[model samples]
Target: MIVRNCNRCGAAITFVRTKKGKAMPCDAQAMPYRVAPGGPVNIMKPDGELVRGYWLESGTGDGVGYRPHWASCRTP
Candidate 1:
């Protein structure tokens, strides 16, 4: 994982390569989430696998994954 700061928001992030060999910046930490079809948020695995789901903040999750940094970025 390549750790760095966001140029727009300054939040720490890690880059995960996608299946297309593209780097996707994600939050530094992994979060648990439940599968939610057509969800607004996404989760990225260490291996670059991504899933659309809702975060299980106070609830049990189906799996753990990293959140896409752009989804929560402060600056547009």
Candidate 2:
């Protein structure tokens, strides 16, 4: 199980890698939420505010890459 926190809001978004090497959102809640490679995400701020943001993927193709970037978020 992989857990990622929103960089802007500090909300938790969890994921799990499948046997075929695909990353998927965990079904911890009744409503499933996921952050795609270049998709937008909804985050909750420390002050209990909801915001919109996206995950930015970094690193080159030759090495291991990381996911779930909280670089920026916008007000909805």
Candidate 3:
């Protein structure tokens, strides 16, 4: 999946990878998801870099950060 961002208004545009690494449109276009940290996750314009990885806690004291990009968003 990919999250593309809007350069003019900072809106997030989400996309999912298809059969050949092609990103296709999805629900995020109508209702872009916002981040818990007061902002939203999005992909960089032109290059479409990931803005932040979104993850929901499974249980208490999960203490993630196992993968290098796991906690790519915040210090959760």
Models 1 onward score TM values of 0.81, 0.25, 0.23
lDDT per residue for candidate 3 within 1-76, as digits (tens), equals 4666544444454555544566544334322222333333432222332334333345322122121122132322
Error of 2 at 3 (Å): 3.2
Q: Estimate, for each residue in 3-40, the C-alpha lDDT of model 1 and write its tens digit.
A: 89999999999988888899999989878788787987
Q: Return the clash pairs for model 2, or none.
A: none
Q: Per-residue lDDT tens digits of candidate 2, residues 1-74?
A: 45666444555655545445655443222222333444465533222233344423543222222222332323
lDDT score at residue 7, model 3, on the 0-100 scale: 42
- Runs with alpha carbons beyond 4 Å of true place in candidate 3: 1-4, 25-76
| Candidates sorted by lDDT, best first | 1, 2, 3
Reference-based lDDT, residue 19, model 2? 46
Q: How close is candidate 2 to the true structure, as a TM-score?
A: 0.25
> Model 1, which residues run further than 4 Å from truth?
58-60
Best by lDDT: 1
